[model samples]
Structures are given as structure tokens and as C-alpha cells.
Target: MNKKIAASLASIVALSTLAAACGTPADTGTKTGGDATQAPAQKVKLTVWHNYSGDDLRAKAVRGQIDKFKAAHPEVELDAQAIPPDGYRQRLKTVAAANEMPDVFFTNSGSMIKEFYDGGLIQSIMPLLNKQTEWKNNFTPGAFDPLSFNNEVYAVPVNASVTSLFFYNKTLFEQNGVKVPKTWDELLAAVKTFKDKGITPISLGNKAAWLAQSSILSSLANRVTGTDWFLKAVKQDGAKFTDPEFVQALGLMKGLADAGAFQQGFNSLDNTQMEQYFISGKAAMMIDGAWALTNMAATGTKEQLDQIDVTVLPSVPGGKGDPNTISGGAGGGFAVSKKPTGKQLDAALELIYTISGPDGMKAVAEANQIVNYKMDVDQSKVTSLFYKAYNLTKSVTFTPVYDAYLSSQGAEAINNGLQELLMGGKPEDIAKKLQDAQAKSIGK
Candidate 1:
């Protein structure tokens, strides 16, 4: 696995030797002069884990930040493991169970963060956060809300994202005389218009099975039932996933597929293929995470970048939910494990601050990715397209992505059921399946 165990062992040995040579058996102090000579800072070794192994720009930016942090803190021994994103959650949970988690690790600000917090696997970041008011204020307002539990924050959110944005080709929309839809009916009309022109209205690649559920259905559910119903259903406070409103959200997914909104054989294609389809102009629009803005900038030509515009999904007609609400929260960031003392704790905290602080966020933004830190970038240095998409978060109300608030098992069931729904499963059936999963998650 090349998990960097050797580096850690070497660090432990070095630290042990240093500890053994300290003052006296009982002194425990490193000071050695009559004038209270200060000893050198104790050696600190920290293991950091993150889901950023690929050559994608996001991963590259993280790697760059780690390099900078290391260069700036030569006294701290930082062992970082960039695990593949696919297996990240499983690995995190496994290590967490063993109580041998890395000193610092990247995690989303959602259910898993709460799970870790409740299990005492993660620690509150307030100690360092309180001392750095300027750093804390650098985050966008409410960005840390999801990472909080029982009035204490557990992680520093690095990236902000909205999961329900529909990015469309402006040229295609203009050519087809189709305006960006502002409401449910207008959206369907635009879909019909594109269909009439023999153009695919949407490109969806759901082979991963999560794009439809987490990216699409999550937004639709928020549009139909709002955050209140979702919370009620998730908490089992008399509301249920099987409630008619929730089922109706499922039905909406079926209706879109039935209406031929997606490209043919979409279920067979993966997210990368869908991005290709959209960039190639084979599809008029794509529904995806706002984080895709970076990918688009990195891979798309200038013409394509100029033609792309992002907007929230249209509102559901006659639904209780607010149309302006979008499914998303603060994106993944670093969390400190409950373990670590003295210098180890200091190193972990420093790493978090260095990665998510203004300096780190500025470097991240320069890489064309959005950051949660509140700073206005120098416009001339970045593409205007990037700024356009980054500003989209301000207009919409944010809600948690479906899987973000659900347990792993609950999320898996929802994703599976949605894929089935795309293949002609009934909404009621899918709703019941999800309800069953939710019940199991809560031990009911």
C-alpha cells in the first residue's frame, strides 16, 4: 500500500531518542542553562491523509500546498498519504475503528464528520481557531456550520461548492433561441426545444450511480421538499422518506429520464465521459458540482470556457421547497484526529491552518479551484469564467447534498435506488427502499 509507515517509524525513533536525552529522570524539561536557556522546539511528526492521488488540477493544487507547508516548517516531520478518492471513505472508517487514524486527515463536512466527532475519533479545532480570529474570519459566512456539532467545530472547510448547478453552452442556447430556464415549466420547454433540434438537452453519466442520486436527485429533493422536510425525514421526527413529497422527488427523476432529457446510453457512461460529451457540444447542458469549474478551465478550450455559464436547477412548480435552494455544503477539508499531544498536536494544527488559510486558499484559487476562504482574487490572473462560476454560490440558498447528511449505508441505498428509478423503477418503490435504509441507519 506504500502508506508511508517507514517514514513514520523513522520519525518515532528520532523523537524517542530526543525525548530520552532530556534533562533528568524527573525534570522532563529541555531547558539547560542557569538563565533558563530555552531548548530547541521538540521534534514533531504528523501523518496527514487525503483523497487526492490523481493528476487532476485539484490534486495538483493540494500537492503544491503540501510542498509549501513542508518548506515553511522544516522542524515538523509531515508524512502525507494521498489515497485514491474511490477507496478513501472505507480506508478512513477502517483506520478510525482501529483508533490509529493519521494525526490529520481530509474529510467532508457532513455525516462522516459528525460520525467521527460523535465517536471521539476527531477533535474540536477551537483551540487554534480561537487564537486566530483573522484566520477564522477568512472563511465565508456559514461555511463552518456543517462541520459543527454541539456548538464545537471539528474541521476547517477549504472549498465551497454547490452540487446542483446546470452548466450550459451559451452558444447552443443562443443558436437554439432557448433562454436559460428560470422555473420548472420553462426548463421543460427548453428541453423540448433542444429535442426538436435533435440536440440532447442534458448529458448525464451515471455509471458510478452517484451522479444521478447525489448530484441530481439531491438538488431535486431540495427543490421539491426544501431543507425542512429533508431534515425531518433524516432525523426520523415523524417525517419519512416514504412521505409523498419525498416520493414525488423520486418521481421527478423518472419524469426527466422519460422525457429524454439525458443523452442516450447515459447509464453506461461515467462522469468523465459526460464531461467530454458536454465539452464537445454533444449536449446542451450538464448538471454537476460547482467544483467542475476548475476541471472545465483546465481541460476546456478558451472558446468552450467562454461559452459556459452556470445556474441553479429550476424550481419545482407547486412544491413546498424554495426554488433558490441548492444542494451543497462546504467541500472537503482537513480534520485533526483525537490523538496527538504537545508538538504532534501543534504540527497538525499548523498543517490545517496552512492548507485552508488565506495563503493556502489564494494558491488554490490560482490553480483555478474555488476555496472557502473569503478573499477576492486578482481578476487579471484568473479567467473571468472562473469568477463567474465562483460567484454563483452567492445567489442560491445552500442545503446539504443527499449523501452528505446520510450514513454511508443510507447513502448507498439511495444511490442504488435512484439508478433503478432511472431504469423504470416506481417512485414509491424507490422511496420505500430509501426509507428502509434510513431506518437501518438510525437503528430503527
Candidate 2:
């Protein structure tokens, strides 16, 4: 047995001995159904903080799952606090400093998991999973990989947000006499055609650096190299970000920007504005994730919705990457605090199981959010081009989008350097700055 289980058994033995000596009834029920005695009942009220603002319909649907959990587990009361997505990381850090983190919380699966692991604030979900076989088998293998720290599972993934093709206005494409591009050269040709027709070839929102980092640069990285190379580079396994391939990727992005491929004022545009431009037929294509489908369906007309299309990104000529390779992973997953007691911890695990399992997966997917579980859901329920994007993502092996896979500080450094590069900083200068920051923060 591991240290935690051994200690828990020892404690239970001592407690049972004490109760027997005091002539009191021994609570001899086993945790894993053996001769071991049960731990004493301790009612707990857990506080869970999530960055699920009311404006996000998907977040609201997740909140509804929490409510269902509350109804089912009446003994455990949860105080669900919803924070805005923009400042959630800061808020979580502030709470952690106060030693006031909630018993159960929602967090990004990858870098956030690593940060909390380093801080000793989160507990491994492996122990809990050992007791819940059904729950353990529900998640896809790669889905849970991000939440593992030092080979131990720490979180349960709620959704898989993967990057895939986001093509714009079929009406505009047909009007401009352009077909959906299937190869990198074809894509460039389409861009030229759109430019000649006085329409923007793409809509890119670079105001928030990660947006551009994920959709364009990261997509190019995955295309130029395979997933393993990118992952190894991010993990700093004898790889450098200043390689010719990396430089070449950045140069390609610069070339596209210089050719009037992206919409005017792209540097100032936010995601919502870019989405609006696409829906209004102002841009011919937009590269984004599956989540945009939920947003588009909420606002666009039925005709407008029907005109949208999804496909895998085109394979680059002479590139090492596959056309089907996508950038994506599990986004928000559940993690319990290390400080909670056995019963409370078990309760929290139960809640996670309730939300991320089969029924919950189908419901959330029906609401247009991509799920990471392996069970089959009704495909007809999802009525948007988004499902096609999601299917394409699943059809390919996922390379970690840099923003999701890097250490938090490393991600910030790379994002900042990329932002400067987009705003006219030299590629070599940006590369040097990124390397220096990585060395300083992550130690070679």
C-alpha cells in the first residue's frame, strides 16, 4: 500500500481500538470492503470556485451539473462561486496564498495542474480512482494525461477543447468562386483569390496574444513538425525553440500577415469581433476551436449557420507534419484539495464522477461542448458545424497547443515574446527573449 493508505489504515486501527476500550460500538465497515474499520463520519461543506461566468452558456450547464450533485449528495453542501474567466487565475492564486482554497475546484488540466502540484495545494486523484473503477474507465487515455503529475492523476477532465478548422462564409466562398482549400498551397491560392476580390482572407484576433498563439502559430508548428517534436521542445528535452523550423514557422506567420491575408486592424480585434466579422461575411476563413460553434449557433441565423463549414487544416508542402494533426486537449478538469478528510474527499470524487461520466457527457455535448469521455452519444443532437470540427479533432492525434502544455511562467514568456513579434519585433530578437526567459524561469 502507498503511504497515504497505510497511514489511513493505521489511524483506523487506533480509532477502533480506542472505541473498543471505551465500551463503545465500533464502526467496522471497511472502505474497500475488507476487515479494516471505517473512518468516523465527518460531515463537510465544501466550497468550489469556478470561472464559469453567467454569460457562458456552457459554464452555466456545468453549474447545473453541480446543482444535481448537491441534490444527490445531501450530506455534502457545496458553495459554488463563479468567477469571470479573465481574472480567474489571479483570483485562484490570491485564495491559495490565504490558505483558503476550496475543498473542490475547477482548473485547467495541464499547466495549472503542474503549478498546483508544485505548490502542494492539490491532491492526487489516483487513490480516489482506485475505488471507482467505472469512473476511472470513463475518460479517454490522452484526456487524463495532462492532469497527471509525477505519474499520479490529479484531476478529472470535464471537456476536451481541441483546435480544428474554422472556415468562413460559404456564401462568400461561392461568390468569390473559391473552393475550400485542402492543401497548404491551395490555401495560399485561396487567400490570394480573396484578396483579389477585395475580401479579407482570414480573421485573426491578436489583441490577446494566446488567441493568435494557438490558432495560427501553434497550428503552423504542429504542421511543420509532428506532435512529439513540439512536446519535446516544450518539455526542454534537448530541444531549443530557436531552431530553424521554429524560425521558419514564425516567418510564415509574418509572411501571411504582410500579404494582407488577415483582416484590417487584426492586431486590435478580439475574438468576439473576429467571430462577428466571419458571421457577417466580411472574412473568407477563420482558424479557431470547436467551442466557437456554440457561440455561432447562439447568434447567427439558421441560414448563416448552415453556410459555415469545418475541415482539418491543410498539410504544409514539404512539412513533416500530417494534415490531420490537431492542437487540443482536455481543458477544465476537477481536482480535490489535499487537506480534505477521507469522507469529504470521497464525496468530492463522487461529484466529479457524476459530472464527467456518461449522462453528463451526453448532456454537455448536446449543449455543443466537446467531451473527452469514450461513450457514444446521439450525433443528431449536435446540430452545428462544430461537431464536424470536433470529429476532425478526434480523428487526428492531438499535439499540445503551446499555451496549454507549457509551464505557466514559460507560457507567459513565450506568449509575451510572440505578442512582441506580431507587433513588429524581429524573429531572432523574439527567439532570444523567449530562450532567456525560459532559462531564467525554468533553469535551462
Candidate 3:
């Protein structure tokens, strides 16, 4: 969380408490059940805020699950709203300002989760999960670690994601006589091969800026400075962004750009356009988040889809990082409100469990999206691309992306500075810019 955002939320929450209550009042009086000691099963009406507003496969799958959940629990009314994807944090902040936080909502696992937990805005679902042991065991090992703070889990793993990946068109590669690259030199050679054949070597949509940071630099940084150094720098423990290892990481990105490795005017292209280029076979390869598999499935042709595959960014020879490592983690999930009472809390917990559990994961798998849960999914029903991505993730040592590890301001600065670096800016200068932003961010 950014310090400014935290402070603003604190003030708003404080003020909102004076004029408004956190949640609706519900009757918890005794009702009919096997156990008379239990409170009445009051009806719960929950507002779920999420970012699946678009008509994509993930959204469709989520809506399908929500319908199933509704069918299973007819008494519960879930008013789910699809929030706009852009600047969602600002909208959340505004809602928090009014003390109208949703009963349950989608939240990422990093700084936002920590700040929400620290501010008493969200509650730990560990106790609920512990009680539901079967459901608890359905998550992949270490999946909950990102959502856990001080050994206590606060959120349920919903969407397990690996952000840094080389999504390539296998058809293009084979047609052009290019093989999947395993090392820096091989990757460069492939880039040259594609470039010489008048095909765009790689499609990068850096206009959004974070795409560069999340898709390329995040993994490259890991390959250069290693995860330990990056984590230490995130904590401001004497590891500076301007360090040689970090500078070298920036240099690698610039080198690729200079080599015409990416589509021309890539810095001006948004992620959507870049995806267009790749899906249409105008670009041979693209580096993107694992979540892109869903987009690819929805937008690509059967032939194109069959030819799609993924790999981790190739190793940089003599780099501190392992070639088997990649940038990834538990990206986002669901967290219940700390203030919901009576059946609202129960229903919210159930919603999280059902949506993030094995059944929900199966649905996600059916949609060709990777769910974070540990479950056996029928791979035959999904595309081969999904299996390739799954194997790629399982093989790599995961590292959190810079945005996930840094404060909002620091993360934004990194995205912007890296964009400048991609546009012919010096690595040292961008490194200093990132260092300065990180200084102020950590200080705050």
C-alpha cells in the first residue's frame, strides 16, 4: 500500500465510523436447527466487487460459478458488481472512504492485503478454512503464503498466476525454423532469425508501462539480481535499485529493444493491440502474464491456439538467478469483510470457499484459466497450451513481480522508468529514477 493511500483510508474510516455503520444490522436470535445454541440463520445479502467486467472467458466462468453458488444457496442474495478494470484501487479507496466496503470482494495478495488487514478492513479466513479441512487442503502448496501475514492467512487463493512468460507461436517458430530458446544467446538468435524473415520478433505492449515491468523486467531482474536481492531491495534493507545487478537487468531490456526484438512502436502499443499482433500471427512471440492464456483461448483460432506454447524467460549466462526460476506468485483472491455479522459473514466465507475451492478451480480449468487451488483437472478438456503453461509454472521457482512487492507509488515509478529505459533511456539514469521513487516510497 502507498502511505498516502493508507493515511487517507485511515482518515476516511475514522470519519465514516462517526456518521455510518460498517455493515447492515441483522437478527441473530435463536431459530430452528439441530443445535439450539446456534444463532438464527439470517438471510445474507452480499455485495461482491470484482474486476471481471469484460465479456471474457474468466468472467463468463466466474458468472457461471456464481450462478451455481446461488443455486446451492437460494436464501443468499449475492449482488455481484463487475468493477471497471482500470484504476480499480481508486474505486476501492473511495468505497472505503464511505465505509461501504463490500461484504466480500476480490483483492490481490500483496501490499493491499497487508494494509487491509492492518487497518481492520478485512478478516482472516484461516479459521474458516481450518474448520473446512478438505477445502483448505485443495490449494497448492505455498499458495496461501502470499496471502498470509505473520503466519495467519487472510485471503483464499483464487487465481494462481505466473506473470513472466514467453508465449510464442509454435507455428511461426517452426515455419521460420526457430526453436524455443533456453539461454540468452539462443533467445537473441531467435530474435534475429524472426527479424530477418520480416516477422516481428516479439510483441510488447509497453504503452501501459507496467507490461514491461511485469512481463519482462520482473523476470529479467530475477535473472540478474536474483529474488533475494530484489526482495531485500523491496524492504529497503541496503539493497538499492541502482546496484550493478539491477542496472544490468535494465540493460538487458534495452538491448532487446535496440536489436528490434519487439514490434515497431511497441512502446506506443497497449496490451490489447500487442495481443492482436500475436494472435493474428503478425508477431512470432510475446511475453505476458499467465492469465493471458484465457485471452488467448477466447480470441485465438483453433490452429493458432493449438500452436501456442509458453516458456520462462531464457537464462542469462553467468547471471545470479537460476534459469529454472520465473516471476510469479498468488496474484489475487477473495477476502471477507471484518465487519460483516450474522449470516453475512457465513455466506461470504462460503462464497470464498466455493469460488476458490476444487469445484471452482475445475470451472476455471475448464475455461483454460489456471486456478490456484490444488486439484486434479481433466487436461483433455483444456487446450495443450494450458498444460504447457502449467508445467512451466510447476518447473520454475516463483518470484513476486515488482509491482506486487513494491508500494503503489514505487511500482508506478518503476513502470514509468522502465518505459523510458525501453525508449532508449540509459540504464543508470532509469535506475536512479527508480531508486529515488523507492526512497520516498519506503520513507513514507
Candidate 4:
């Protein structure tokens, strides 16, 4: 996440800052300011894509809003695709290389969105927001900062998120007579104890590559390298990934795998499979994002859900980071393709606002996810598991997610390198891979 998101997140710490419900943007085919969106008199077709493709509650909330938008605007024919996170980026890049971007698409903050903006791949949505003045005013101030570049807003964040947390089965921990770890040494002891009992100490699925980067290593690396040191390294400001502190962080992953912490073939398994391993009690712990809470709330049995509780990744020896913090916040969002105009721009603006606006934000909130909008919610409708995860954010600081802020090449190198590192690759070699990849951009 960016600085603006970090600043805005403090306002949402307890959900107590929330206001009464707000309204959605105006109807389709309406003109406001002179340069504002003007729907075409005839039918308009726009291509749309997003990463909320799984069957999880988070995905349903997003896709549900898209469905409503289609129904409400019959004059617009949307050719939409719901691609999984693993394949979504590459696909968008492929289309972009061919100069064939969709009319509107999903993207994250930091280097990912910056790449598109720098390449002239996206257009400013500021005029569209200016037209919907009331809707624009409702977002937590500074929520739009990450999506704005060169004083022009390009996208709107659908939600803010915490990308790392430890979800442990309380029943398993109690059954085994082991408590949650609060320090590196205690964590190692817990892993050894769980391993001795033939139970996987941690459930992990790294096949998609990102769980290794964003979920596992983001928080772990933060503990070892801290935010300031890491940002300097990211900017190549007298810092490199090959430094001993970052190397020590990479070693932690190797240390976990060597200690029999993760399940077999973790590099090949997907999140759905990992969730099954966790709920079945074969593994006592799972490390994932806040999004998992909603996915669990939707599909988990009440008994199963009740047995789970959330905790932060424990502190490291001589750690430079706070144990309570994790990598996440207002990052990924939606933007229109470069130079969209007339009917196409209108369709694109309406699509993003409808989903990221009041109705969409409320739908996301009801599914137990954090959002940028302020709306009163019925406490009874949200699951206890969600509150457990939600309230955990109150006491901690938030860190930048690795992928959210890293250059695409740097993100790629580490994501793949971590998989290799876990499979017995040397941490030094992997660290150098990132050092080289990032220098390509920052070095210049």
C-alpha cells in the first residue's frame, strides 16, 4: 500500500468511526459537468476484467455488484472476465503489450499501477469524480491518493485489506497443550512439538507464488528488515536485498521449511486445498490475509469457525519491526484504459464508481471485509470470526505489502525465488536475483 492508504487506515481502526449509510453514484446516461461522462444515445459495449474470481465471499461480493451494474444499465453491453489472481496480471500485460487493453480493468497501487500510468496505459478519472461530487466526498479523505498520479486520479480502491495474519485452530493448540508463539524461539519450539506429533505445524499453499511473497514473507521480512530499511532497499538508496538483514529474513523461510513446519508439496497446493488441510485439523496453523476470514465465514461450519482464532506473526530475534504489524492496506483498484472518451469513458466511469461507491462498499462490508466508505453496519450480521480478525487491526501498525509496492520485475524475481528457496535453494542466490532485477529500474 501507499502512504495515503496508510494514513487513511488509521481512521478505520475500530469501525467506530463509521457513519450512517451513504448513496451510490447517479444513474447511467446522465451528464453532469461539461467534461463529465456522457452516455451514448445508442448501445455501448465495454470490456471489463477483475481478480475477484474465486468462490469465496470476497469474490461474490464484487461479482454481485458487477451483475447489478449490468442489470441497471441495459444500454451497456459489458464483456467481462473474472480471472484468478495468478493469471490476471500476465493476461492484462499480454493484452497491454498488444495495445489492446480492456476499456476498464483491475490494478493495484505502487509499481503495478505506476507501470501502467508511466506507460500511458490509463486515463485520468478525476473529471468523472468531479461530476459525482457527493459520491467523491464520501470516501475517507486520502483514499484516492494511491490511485492518483501527477495530480490526476486514475482509479478507485474497492476496499482496504490486511494481507497477512496467523489463523490458528484453538482446539488443536489446546489438544496438543501448546500455546501460540510470541517470539521466534517459541515459534520454533511449537513447530518442533507439532512436527513430533506428525501434524503439519503450518498449512501453506505457495503454488500461486503470491502467498509466498505477500502473505508469508511480507510480514516476516518486515520483522527482519523493517519498513524504512526495506523502502530504502526498494528505492536502491544505499540498500540492497543482498544485505545481511534481508538475507536473514530469507533464511527464516528456509528455517521454517527445514524445521518441518509446512505441509508436504506446499509449493504445488492451492489455497482451497490448504484451507481444507487447515479445517480438517491436519495442520494447527494457517497464515493468510483478512480475506480468508470472509471466505471462512461463508463456507465454514459454525463449530469449525469457532475453533479458529487470529494472531500476529511472532517477533524475531533482534527484530527491527513490530510483531503486531502486517503488510496490507489500500492497494489494488480499478482504472480506465488510456484515452477512453464519449460512451466508452462513461461506461467505464459508471462501472468503477458503482462498485467502489456506496452500494459496492456496503456489500463488501456485509461480507465482513474492511472498506474505504463510511456506512453503519448491523453488528449482528457480521460473524464473530470477522470481528476477531477485524479488531486485531486496532492494536497494530500496518506495513507496505511487498508486491503492492515492488517493481513488477522485482516482485517476479522474489516470488519465484521464495518458491525455490523453500525447495532448498540458497537464500543468497535468491537475494541476488531480486538485487539484480530491481537495479534494472532503480539503477537507471
The candidate that wins on lDDT is 4
Clashing pairs in 3: none
Quantify how close model 1 is to the true structure by its C-alpha RMSD in Å.
Answer: 6.1
Model 3 residue runs over 4 Å out of place are 1-43
Instruction: Give the TM-score ranking, best first.
Output: 4, 1, 3, 2
lDDT of each residue in 1-444, candidate 2, tens digit only: 899989987897798778767878544433655776565444467778787664444676788888899988767867888887657887888888888888888888777777888899998878767887786787777777888877788887788867655566788888888888877778888899999989999987767667777776777777886677777777677667777777777777666776778877777877767877887778889987766676676567767778888776777877778767667877678788877877778788877777776667766777677788876656676656756666666677766777777766767777777767766767777666666666566777
Candidate 2 or 1, higher lDDT: 1
lDDT of 1 by residue, 1-444 (tens): 355977876787687667777733664445678866564565578899998676657678888888788998878878999997667988999988888999999998788788888788988889889988988987887888888888788888878756777788899999989999988778888888998899999989998787887778888888888788888888878789999899988888798888889988888887777887898898998898765666666678888788888878888988887777678868878999888888789888888888887777887787677777777878776666777867777676787788888887888888888888988889999899888888888987
TM-score of 3: 0.86
TM-score of 1: 0.88
* Deviation (Å) of 146 in candidate 2: 1.3
lDDT (tens digit, per residue) of candidate 3 on 251-348: 88899988999877887988778887898899888999876787777787778878778878899988988878778787688888777777788888
Decide which is better by TM-score, 2 or 4: 4
Q: State model 3's lDDT.
A: 0.81
Q: C-alpha displacement of 21 in model 2, angstroms?
A: 38
**TM-score of every model versus the real structure:** 0.88, 0.84, 0.86, 0.88
State residue 232's C-alpha deviation in candidate 2, in Å: 3.3
